[model samples]
Target: MNEITVSLPDGSKRSLAAGATILDLAASIGTGLAKAAIAGKVDGNLVDLQTPLADGATVEIVTEKSPDALHIIRHSTSHLMAQAVKQLFPQAKVTIGPAIETGFYYDFDLEKSFSPEDLEKIEAKMRELAKADLKIEREVLSSADAIELFRTMGEDYKVELIQDLGAESVSLYRQGDFVDLCRGPHLPRTSLCKAFKLTSLAGAYWRGDEKRAMLQRVYGTAFADKKELEAYLARIEEAKKRDHRKLGRELDLFSFNDEVGAGLVIWHPKGAMLRTILEDFERREHLKRGYDIVLGPQILKTELWQRSGHYENYRENMYFTTIDEQGYGIKPMNCLSHMMIYKSQLRSYRDLPLRFFELGTVHRHERAGVLHGLLRVRGFTQDDAHILCTPDQLDAEIKGVLSFVRDVMGIFGFDYEMELSTRPEKSIGSDEDWERATSALLSALKDSGREFEINEGDGAFYGPKIDIKLRDALDRRWQCATIQCDFTLPERFELTYVDADGEKKRPVMVHRVILGAIERFIGVLIEHFAGNFPTWLAPVQATIVTVTDNQIPYAETAFNTLRAAGVRVQKDFRNEKLGFKIREAQLQKIPYMLVVGDKEVEAGLVAPRFRDGKNLESMTPEQFIAFIQDEVKSYR
Candidate 1:
């Protein structure tokens, strides 16, 4: 008998036959583990339980306790959904199914659309199939044979996918009567996908091309157990209530119309005020940190973009215009202009670490289907900055950016996590440059003592980056800040600084955004605070209400006093009931309300009430101004 040595993660070894499978190994260790195992990791790569072991290979059983288990379950559930859909509607042709961050979705081409009831039927069928516990089997077939088989079943979409793969052979998974072409590590049986539900349905173009056939995409989610699924559904409900778009309309912050075109935001008066407050804070903060403010033209000549590599790598997402036979490209990034500034004059090692800041608005050619409120927009302003530093200063500059992100996010009361994204498949620059850049970011993150995850192949086209996603009150994560380290752009533009040895060397660049996009940050803030902004950021910080017509004079005086003190104040001098005015103010999400009545007028004081229904003791105009200033300062 041929024997193999299997190395465990804990440095233990087990002697087994070379042909033994992961399932066999698990059963040998413990029956409980064998039952819990969904898959196995052979030398760090996920594989199915039935995968045969090799000599001296390290193996780890992947169970429900594994971090990757949910993704695997969700992916397997997507396939089960396709199978169920096929069983219910034989006319439907499945295109692709994949697991997403939220859950899973499968696109299908059918003559008729799927109604809500159809989703129910498909879910019910999935449950039935799970109960049947059908064994899922895998096979490898020649591309020709696979295409012929799918073609025989009238699955033109599958045939097209297989033909496009351009591989000699393909992997296929079959469970009972349904089979799918996939490179998979699916659950051994359908029973593992029991705790799942069909979420919603939408229309997606085949291959995302408008000219291609439009397919119906069915979204769903699966969990390890029923309780987990229920918890996720509860979060979904809460997310709906905290949706920024709903709050934006309710609070009259901003709007978008067909007349203004999609993905373009028209800020209302209150929204503009909110943005103004944020911008003022941003400018002051940047100045305090020794950053020099800068501005760039909206559209630069196309030749400049080509020189910066944006034309080659990012042209698809950029807007280009031809003016009087001359070509120009609207800037999708602020880094280009910052780079030109660096090259404008001779820089020495002593003048290194130049930080340039900009509140620059940029336009992107985002697809219409993906645009949503202020979160995903065509035009948005970024709290963007770029730093040029020598190689020796790279680590410190990265740490400075991290500190800036921490402080800004703290001010916003946002709990965030960092992700170090490595070089992407389509990115430029040499391996050595990417390696150096990634190392600097990693070292900075470690030195900061902040926990960060690695997101492979999700960096910018020119460099590796650290993406900071903030967690809202509802625990939903939003990507709002990023710190990117680039070595390619400087090289592309031939940027150099005289070193201590009097030799010119390429300088490193750091492209970072503290608040990502102004519009998106506002959207996140709206949801985070549930439209009830804090005193500092509130559009209407305080509202002065007169209890009676006689108190109008005092209310006017109070409003004027607060306004002169730099508070965003509003006045309600109508003959409406006092309670009605207060209720309206509370509904408008003002942080404070000053009530002026007979007693307040006589004492030359104002009664302050919080939007939370807490009343403070009466204070004179001077005292009230001092109190509000203290509170605002505390927030800053």
Candidate 2:
């Protein structure tokens, strides 16, 4: 046999017999490496260990410790799950399964819905298959042959998918009697799929189209080891306990009614108060940052949306109506009105950077299936702002917004990541404008010295943007802030300012939101804090619990004094026992409870007890009011 030379990741070369596979190369290095090898990377592309290494090809042996290991393991585990499902329910047909960010999911079309008991059986079967350690092999066949093979197996979905692929050849992976159509690079054997668990089941439309057949989606996750899997499961349990919807109901914050409609939030008193506090904070922050408070009409002429490219690019998400023979669009974005405001005035270069801020309420037609409690609602308010600045000033404006995001996230004790999304295929604007806008955002992000990833082809239709995703207590990412740079929209609306040379020049617009949506942020906060809001943010900061009927008069006096002094205080004077009232208040997550008894009345003081069972020293009403004020100011 002829000798072949292959390049290792460390830039070293190894001579082996021609047609040597990646597994053979691993063995050549060391026996331990061969045993640890689960897959291989050939010239940066993941491949099976059986893949032949071409002469002089760059290769890296993938072990369980590699970053790509989990994805490959999860993908293979999905196949393991599919094989189990097929063995248990031969009537069920498989469609597609792919590894997602958190885990993997496989979709199945069956006449019966999957129950929890069925999941257990399927999982048990998967364990059995894994224990058998069946050798998994990949095979390529002509598209026509692939379709015929799936058709014989009664997999209509697979056949349809293969036909739609319109390819000359297709690859399929087979383990035992079970086979699935997929791209290359899976585990060599079934037993490698050890640390896996089927998390949940959901109903998903085939290909995400509501008109198509609904399929059962089995969600599962796989880790490199059992310890990591256990940790993930523990986090998931904690997440369930901290779910915002459950906390909302328990804390009497918000609700959604069928009578009102889907994706619309009905805020209760406490929820409304929380929202108001957040909005007030946004206003003060914006004002301090030199933003001019502004408001726009809820509905605008549809022609304006068309002129702004929204009607052409985003019409599906917009609501339209005819008012007095004039077509109108309920504003789904606040950019158009801000543009109108810019064009409303004649300006010089001195007035170049006009920052207009609005706590704008907008409506979008969100699909019912995607809407969650308050996170993905149709009707919501945004802390939206637009900064119209000269081209030279664009970088500063964007960095300012980045600084604003950093400060706000720090205040909330949240760690966040940023992604720079570039132009999408369906976006509007000239290539030159798109490049300029993308470059501006990129420059600002780089100058800020913060690491960010480039998310390709996910930008808004008009321009590129920086998306800020904040990590919560469970390390889950939520889309909270965004900064979008647009050179096209100002040109579309013909917004111009006089330059130093007295020539009218088009100004660039930076549309940004520090906290993307008020409702979503509040939901994130509820989950982040687990409904135990800090003293400053608690809707009812303090409550007065009278020791007995004799103390009601004193409790009422204390409550009125606190209320007058600007404390969010409530009184529990229903003639209840002190401990009972204290327990109820604690359940409500009130920050402080002031107990009024005969002794308290005599001393003209209140016994303050913290929700965590710590007792503050007795203080007069005036002194307590000052303490609360000081605590609130500390958050600021």
Candidate 3:
């Protein structure tokens, strides 16, 4: 037999038959590996265990420990589901099945509508197929032969897909009696898919085109280990309990009225109070940092946006209106408005970096399917700002923004990960300009000593950008801070300043938002702290519960004093048991509960209890006030 050298993960080489499969290599190594092997990586591309080896090639057997093996398993599970569908509904035409973020989905076009009963039947068939432990086999054929096979098999979607294949051959996989048109790196046998569950079913347009066939898509999730699968299901249950939409209703935070609009969120009293507190804290911080607050209009002439290039690229997301027979658009970004402000005045090198800030509410029309609570809503307020400066001033401006982002995130006790997104394929500006902007962004992140990954070809059309993701209490990451560099917007809008050289040059624009959207950030805050906001930020911070009617007078006095001190105090003087009143306050997650009884009243003292059930000894009312004040001050 012809022999070939296979490179192993340990930097060692092994000689084997040139046409050998990955299973053969694993068997040579040990039974343990052969049993554990799920697939193979040949020259870095995932493939089946039966692939013929290339001479002097790299090979690594993928096992449960391999990171990408989960995706391989999910892909295979999707195929298995499709196979089950085909087995049950022989007339069901399979289209495409792909691995998703946390699951897999397969689309099928069937004459009859599928119901919950059908899902149960499909799942039972899947388990039956899994128990068979049938070997998964692969076949490669010429393009013409593959097309003919799909055509003969009555898979029109597969035939349509094969027409686009410019390659000489295509691969197909089969297990038991069900064969599929796929390029798979599937498990060796059906038994390897130990745990999986069908999640849901939805209607999707073929290729997302409504004109095409409406396909029924079945979604499912798979895992390598059963314990992890159970844990994931448990987390999903916990997430459902903590969902902001449901929590918002239970907490009376906000509401969306269909009569008003789809994406417009109306903050209720409690929510508005929270917003005010958050905004107040941010305003004070900005003022101390020498940031100049400015205002901009909600509507601008379409000509202005055209100059800013928003009309060309982002117009689809913008809301356009006609006024005075001229087209106008509701702003989707604050950068354009700030740019117009900078252009309104002349500046010299002495005024190098000008930071103009706004809590701008902007409108962007999003698809109906993508909206989820406040997290993905349209028409939201952004804590947005723009800095116009020269290349010499870029570093300091970046440092300032970084420091602000860090301080803000730090306030919430948020730990963050960073990503630097570079230019996209269809972006504006010269190649040289794009390179410089990307370099500036990367340098800022490096200088700050922040670890970041590069997201290639994911930047905004005008410039490269830096994005910050904060891991919440659930360990779920949410992208909240964005720092972008824009050269094209300034040039397009003819925004410039005079340098020491006495010549006019376009100023570079830096758009940054520390807290992306007030609504989304507030929603995140709800989940992060489980609705127990910090003392200063809480809508109702302290509740004074009286032990009896005699103590009610003292509670009222104490509440009055606390309110005058701006402590967010409330009086709970209802004729009820002290324990019941305390329980009510705790349920609301109020940061503090002050208990007043006749003995404490006579002693001019009170008992302090933190919302988390920590207690303090009886203290003078004056001491209690001082302690709560100190806690609030420390929060700032």
Candidate 4:
């Protein structure tokens, strides 16, 4: 037989028959590897184990332990799910199904909406199909033939997709009696998708267009083994318990009303207090870091947005209104006004770095379907700031923002990851400007000594950015802080500074936010702490509970004293039993509960009980106030 040489990932070469498959290569290496291999990567592209190996190509075996294994498993499981759904409901038409970061989902064009019972049945069928160990084969066909095949199968959505591709040929994957249009690099057998579960179902618009037909989306997840699947399910359960919307009502923090409109948050008293505390912290931090607090109008002339490229690139997310026969666009961002501030005066290199901070409230036209509780709300306030600096000062300014993000996230006990996002296809500015902006951000990220990922083509419309995603207690990542380096915006707005050499130069703008949207951050905080906010952050630090009505006077005195001393204290002198009051306070997640009884009133002291059922030594109200202050200072 003719011989061919192929390179392994470890840079070793092996000679095999000319038409050798990846499976052949694996078996040539070892029986152990051949048994473990589920897929392979040939020259950096994933392929099935049976794919023909090209001479001189580098190959890496993908086992269950490989990083790529889960994605392939999840994607194959999605097909498995579709096959099961089709078998159960013969008339169901399959749409797109792809693996997401968390799991996979497939949309079905069926008149009957799937119920919980249906999901159970579909999952059972999937397990049976996996046990059957059906062979999964990939085939190529001309576009015309593929369309006819799908049309014959009554999968109109697949037909439309093929037509949209306008390709000469397409790939399809088949297992048992089920065949579907896909770009195949899937599991070779159904049995490999054993550790899978159908999670939930939801309604989705076909191709995400509201005008299109609504389809039923069945969501699911797959793992390499049952143990990993169990762990993920446990986390999902914990996430449900920490769900902010549920805790928001239970803790009396925030709410939304359909009458008021979707994606709008109405902060109750406690919620408002929480926001006030965070906003106050932001102001103090900014002031300490040499940022000047600034404010801008809520709406600007529509021409300004057009000049900033928001009209062309971001108009869909913005709201516009005509005021007194003049068109105005509600601000979706705070940078435009900050840029105008820099333009208001001729700056010199002596004042090269000017940081303008604002706790600005902005509005966006979020679609109703994507409107999440507080995270994806239309109206929210951002701890936004813009730093304009000379080209020489750009590096330090970027690092300063990085340090700021580190300090703030550390204070909140959030472990975060950073991503350097490059320019997108719809972005503005010359290639040189985008390159410079991206380079500056990348340089600072490297100097920070922290690992980050490259997120290509996800930058802002004007420039590149460093996006910070904070991981919460349950290991879920939340998008919070961002540092955007924009040379284009300053150039467009004509922002300039006098160079040391007596020449006019445009200063680079670094737009950033530490906490991002206050509403969203609070929601994250709620879940992170599980409503058990630390002493400093709790809206009510302590509630004064009386054992009897006779101790009301003492409880009232303690509350007044604590309030006067800057403690967020509440009085719970209701005629309820002492245990009941304590239980209620504990349910509220208060950090401290001061128990006032006749014995304590006689001694002019109160007992402090922590919400976790720990008791502090009995002390006078003044002493407790000092202790609370010490605790707050400790956090700082």
Candidate 5:
């Protein structure tokens, strides 16, 4: 046999027959490894275990312990599910299926809706198929032939996909009588999808197009082991309990109405007050950092957007209007206004590092299906800021933004991860500018001494950026803050400052948002605390509950006193029982409940009952104020 040399990831070389497959190499190495190996990576590309080896190729066998193994298993599991569905309901036609972040989902074109019992049956069939251990073989065929085959099978969606792809050849995976069009690096056999479960079902538009047919989507998750699957299921249960949409309604925070509009939030009184407190805190922090608060018009001329590159890259997501028969675009970002402000006057290098901040409201055209409560909305406010500085001060400004993000996340008790996103395919700016911007972000991340991963091809259209994802109490990550370094915008807008030599030089622009969007941040916060906000951030810090109508006057007086002392107080002066009032207050998630009874009123004191059912000794209103203030101070 002709011999070939293959290099392993650890710098070891193996001489094997040219016709040898990855599985053969694994078995030759060790029995345990061959048994554990699910797939292999050849020359940095994932391939099936049975792929033929070539000379001077780099190979790495992927076992259950590999990070990429779960994804492969999940993708294979989705195929298994599709096969199971076909076996149970032959009339059901399969569409597209892909492995998502949570797990996987496959869409099917069927006349009947899938029920919970159907999911169980399909799951049982999947297990049966896995037990059979059928080999999954890949074959390449001309697109024309594949289209004809799917057409004969009554799978119009598959034919549509093939036609839309416009490829001359396509890859198909076959397991017994089941076959799917895919560019697959699937498991060698069905049994490798050991631990799997069908999660839920929903309706999705074909290819996310409203005009296309609606397909039934079955969601599922698979793991390398049973323990991991169980843990993921537990997280799903906890996630359901902590869903912000459910909590928003239960806690009376915000609402969306069909009558008004879709993807629009209507904040209730309590919710509005909570938002006010957050905005005030943001203003104070910005002022302390020497940011000049600024405001701009809600709309600008279309020519300005065209010049700013927004018209070319972001026009689809922007709302346009006509003012006096002239085209204008609704502002989707606040950076343009800040740039105009900087250009309103030319100054020396002494005016460098000028920071402008705004709690600016902007509008975007968010799709209806993607909108979920406050998480995705059409109109929302951003805690946005822009910094104009000389090139020498760019690094320090970038570091300052990272510091702000760290401090803010810490204050909210959020553990976060940072990622540096590089230039995308659909981006502006020259290669040199992108490299400089990315390097500045990389240096800042290194100076901060925090580990960050690189997200290739995921930056803003004009620049590279640092994205911060905060992990909530449930351990789920939320993307809420970002720092973008832009060299293109300054040049596009011709923003310049006079240097010491009196020469015109372009200033660097930094676009950042501590809380990406007010609505989304509040939504994340709701789930992070499970509707139990801290004393300082709570809508009602204290609620005074009276035992009976006789104590209403004292409760009223106590409420006034607490409110006068700058506490957010609510009075429950109804003719209800003491336990009933306390239960109501606890249901509202109020931090402290002041119980006003005859003994407490006579003693010139009010007993404090915490939301957690802890009872404290009676104290004067002044003393309670001091105690609450101390708690607030602790948070700061």
Candidate 6:
């Protein structure tokens, strides 16, 4: 046998026969690693532990403790689900099953939807197969042979997949009576997946083509330990309880009208009030950050979007129309108009970093299925801004943007992850343009000491981007901030500034948003606080609840005084009991409730009760107003 040299992360090497498997290498090291091993990363490619090695290669066994091991467990758990489904519902055809951020899902085309009962039965079978501990075997075969096998098994979707694979040979994973076409580094046995759960089911098209058959996708998540699994499930439960859609209706913050169509939100009066406060807050913050406020028309000629590249690469999401034989589009983005504003006059290098900010509302036609209230909407306002600067100013500008993003997210109490999305397969711009833009983004991120991951081939056709994933209070992440570097637009629009030498140089364009949307941010805020907004941003910061009819006059007086003091106080003067009023106020999550009963009124005092139902000692109306103002000031 030919000798092979295998290297480990610790700079250790072992000589072995050329066909040595990860399991063989691990045994050569110790039984402890071999048992803990789930897969191996061979020269940057993840492969099964049983995979044979070539003459010379770098190898590292992926144990349960490795960062990538959990994903492997989840992916293999997805295969176990397929095996369980096949054993119970043989007619279902599997298409794709991949591990997602927090879970795994398998899409299948079947005659009927799998109900809760069906899931229970399938889960029982899954446990049985897991107990059996069937070894997962890998096989490589020609695409033609794979197509024939799936065809014979009546898996038309799998057969269709083989045709589109565009590969001569495809790897297949088989365990027990189930077989799946996959490029896998799955767990060696069904028992290796220590903990698993079937999460939810949804409808998805075969290949994201709405015209194709809708497949039933069963989502699941797996973890190495039972406690971790339970923790995940608990987090999911908390997230569901905090879902913005439910809170929006329960708190009467916002609604969607069928006549208004999907993806367009109708902010009720209370919602609007909350939004106004947030917008005002953002405006003040932007002014403090030296951003020049700007605005543009909601609709513009098609020629503008064409120059912006929105009509070319993102036309599907844009709404189009015509005015007097000239094509126009509902502005899907604000960058183009910002550019035209810049090009209106020649700019000197002294005005190098011109930052223009806008609370711009734009419309895009999102798919119907993906629409979920403010989170995923068509017509929404973005706290959008554009920065046009010289190449020398790139690093400082991005760092400034990052600081701005951090401040906005801090106001919302959001923790976030950063991602640098590099060039896509189909993109414009010269190699130098791409290189410079990419370097500037990375430089800024490193300078800020922010740790970020890369998303390859997910950038805009025009340039690379920095995406911020803000995690809510429930620890659920949402992509709410983005900084994109665009080179194509500047070139297309011929946008340039005069340098110190009086030479015309194209300015680098940056698109950024801190709080992505006022509407969506409101939704997020609703969930983050469970509809209990900070006193400053609350629609009704404090409510004056009268104890009886006689106290109405006193309550009204107190309300008038607070309103004069600029407090959002509501007069709940109904003839209900004091306890009843307190309960109502608590349900509304009002920050403060000032109860004016007979004693308090006669004493010229108001008994304060926090919305949390914690009763504070009775105090003079003057003292009560002062206390509320302090709370609002602190934004607690």
Clashing pairs in 1: none
Clashes of 3: 0
Give all candidates' CA lDDT scores.
0.92, 0.93, 0.87, 0.93, 0.92, 0.88
User: What is the per-residue lDDT of model 4 for residues 1-636, given as tens digits with 9 covering 90 to 100?
Assistant: 488899988788999998999899999999999998899998899999889987888999999899999899999999999999999999998999999998899999998889999999999999999999999999999999999999988889999999999999999999999998988689999999978878988889998999999999999999999999999999999999989999999999999999999999999999999999999989999999999999999999999999999999999999999989999999999999998888887899899689999999999998888988989999999999999998888999999999999998988999999999999999999999999999999999999999999999999999999999999999999999999999999989988888989999898999999999999999999999999998999999999999889988778888899999999988887889889989999999999999988899999999999999999999999999999999998877
State in Å the error of residue 341, model 4.
1.4
Candidate 5: which stretches are off by over 4 Å? 163-168
Candidate 4 overall Cα lDDT vs. reference?
0.93
* Model 5 lDDT, full chain set: 0.92
Tens-place lDDT per residue, model 6, 537-584, is 889888888878998888888888888888888889998888888888
Model 1 regions more than 4 Å off: 430-432, 496-505
- Candidate 3, 144-188: lDDT as tens digits: 998998899899999888788777899888898788888887888
Instruction: Tell me the lDDT of model 1 at 336.
Output: 87
Ranking by TM-score: 4, 2, 5, 6, 1, 3
| Superposition error at 445 for model 2 (Å) | 1.0
Across 1-636, the per-residue lDDT of candidate 1 in tens digits comes to 589989888899999877999999999899999999999999889888989999989999999989989988998999999999999999899999998988999999899889999999999999999999999888999999999999999999999999999999999999989999898889999998968988899989998998899899999999999999999999888888878899888888899999989999999999999999999999999999989999988999999988887888889999999999999999998998998899899999999889999999999999988898999999999999999999999999999889988998999899999999998888888999999999999999999897899999999999999999999998889999999999999998999999999999999999999999999999999989989898889999889999899998777878888889888899999999999999999988999899999999999999999999999999988898898789889988
Candidate 5: residue 531 lDDT (0-100): 89
Q: Give one digit per residue, the lDDT tens place, for model 2 in 1-636.
A: 598998998899999999999999999999999999999999999999999989889999999999999899999999999999999999999998999888899999999899999999998999999999999999999999999999999999999889998999999999999999999689999999888899999989999999999999999999988999999999999999999999999999999999999989999999999989889989999999999999999999999999999999999999999989999999999998888888888989998689999999999999888999999999999999999999999989999999999998988889999999999988888999999999999989999888999999999999999999999999999998999999999988998899999899999999999999999999999999999898888899999888889888877888889999999998898867778999999999899999888999999999999999999999999999999999999888
TM per model?
A: 0.94, 0.99, 0.92, 0.99, 0.97, 0.96
Clash totals for all candidate models? 0, 0, 0, 0, 0, 0
Off by over 4 Å in 2: none
Clashing pairs in 4: none
Rate residue 478 of model 2 by lDDT.
99
